[model samples]
Target: MVRRWKRVMAFLIAIIFCINCVMNIGVKGTYAENSNKDSNTEEVHTSAEEKEDTTEIEKETTSKAEKNKSDGDLSVDKNEKTTNKTEDDESKTKAVNNTILDWDTYKSKTTLVTVDDTNKRIYVKTGEALTLLSNCSAENYKDYIISLDSSVTGGAIEIPFTYDGYEFKGLGTKECPFEGNFNIANIKIQSTLFAGLL
Candidate 1:
């Protein structure tokens, strides 16, 4: 029975190998055929009239959206400044707390939001990493610890102004929630949470 089982397993392996070889050959042939066609093909061109029509349609859509904003169909700040943006505008121009915004402006700050597994550039306040680093810290010291790793040079405690609303991972205590929507550039809590702001 053992010999029969071995023979069957070997037969299955051989069958799988043959199938894989045939599939590889077929795929290679298909790829070669497509490449040959692409090399010989000429670029398609849109007529001048067609281009003009497309432009006009796009312009019309844009104008309609503008008209809606003017008519108050879209949310617009009544106190919005014409030029020379205020400091508040610069920092608060993003999703706040739990409020969501679809604008690319928020996503543009690649460091703030968790995007594509590129780890957040979170840092501790110079000397806070001594107690906790990897996992969450004590409930009481949750607000104190942000990160243990000190990637910054010169012991610079000031987080950048561009890092508005940046949330720190493995921060906050059991008593206090993790710091979210925090302006690391302008840290207020000094000794209580951050040691210095690295």
Candidate 2:
């Protein structure tokens, strides 16, 4: 009986030792794969929308519109430069054949330049680290994905367009244009008189 009792205690001690070793070793390697499972722990999951919200940058639009009555109706001062809308209209009518480029920014991102020849309108979208040249209309669309250079990731731009510039698409640094592919959906060759008419 004494011998049997001693054997039982020894078996229990060995089992406890194995359990401790597994717990410690699994934690350093793959805890999830551990043989000792804990069922009481709650799982955490985050949705794609939540992930996107976290990645978004804070932006403040300069527009000074009136606040809601609940927030205290305070009128914002009108922007002086925004009145350049009139000048933009003038640019529409004064379209010269010469291509005008405003791509002198120090940063890079995705850019969408949409040309509507029939309506004589242009749309621009620039996003973070992206640039694209596209020819599109209200109904149909085509992209100008030049060399697939990944560096030219475009932005979601909503700025006003400069008048009378031909579409040109580019990607990567000038020294490394082949980093990716670049494509221009369409090209328009115009003389000084014909460019403004389109």
Candidate 3:
């Protein structure tokens, strides 16, 4: 009877030890799985944050690039306008040079007229005189009319003509050749003879 009791006690002790070992192994495995899961979650969060940061940086770079392009376009437009203005000035100068009229060849009331190139005026004898057409009676004079102030010797005269975009104006003698100032638009011509006459 005593031997049987000892055997039964020993068997119960062995069974309890095996149960404790199995429980400890299960707990350790669960803890290791939880640790691995936490590490993976942290990695995923870090990756998501990096992606967001990269997206923001890309957006900023694109915005700056677009602004620079618009500035460049404006610069190009300004340069083009300047070039066009320069070309217009050149064309106006050429037109004035090509339209010089010789007072000797011009058919006036009398041919007794003398031109002073240095003084930019015309002088006629006391007995004879010259004349300029003061009316818009020709086909080429359709844009404007001429008005001469006979009271003043060197007064402003409203002449008719336009070259490109310049209005022709002159101040000269109504009974003699051009004896005062002539201008194309706002540019004054320093010559005794009329320019762009029809």
TM-score of each: 0.22, 0.16, 0.37
Better of 1 and 2 by lDDT: 1
Pick out the ten consecutive residues of candidate 3 with the lowest summed lDDT.
126-135
TM-score, cand. 3: 0.37
Quantify how close model 3 is to the true structure by its C-alpha RMSD in Å. 13.9
What's the distance in Å from true for residue 42, model 1? Answer: 4.5
The sequence of per-residue lDDT tens digits that candidate 3 reaches over residues 1-198 is: 999999999999888989888888888888889888888888889889989999899899899888888988888898898889888887876664345334444324234334444544444421112223222112222232222223335433322344333333332323333333322222223333343333
Candidate 1 accuracy as lDDT: 0.45
Decreasing TM-score order of the candidates: 3, 1, 2
Q: Which pairs clash in model 3?
A: none
Over 1-198, each residue of candidate 2 has an lDDT whose tens digit, in order, gives 999999999999999999999877877566654422442222222444554555452221212222243233222223333456657755764553133233322112224344344553334333211222211111222222222233334432221232223232222222222322224233232221011111
Model 1 C-alpha RMSD to native: 32.7
Ten-residue region with minimum lDDT total, candidate 2: 189-198
Model 2: how far is 66 from its true place, Å?
40
Query: Candidate 1: which stretches are off by over 4 Å?
Result: 42-198
Collision count of model 3: 0
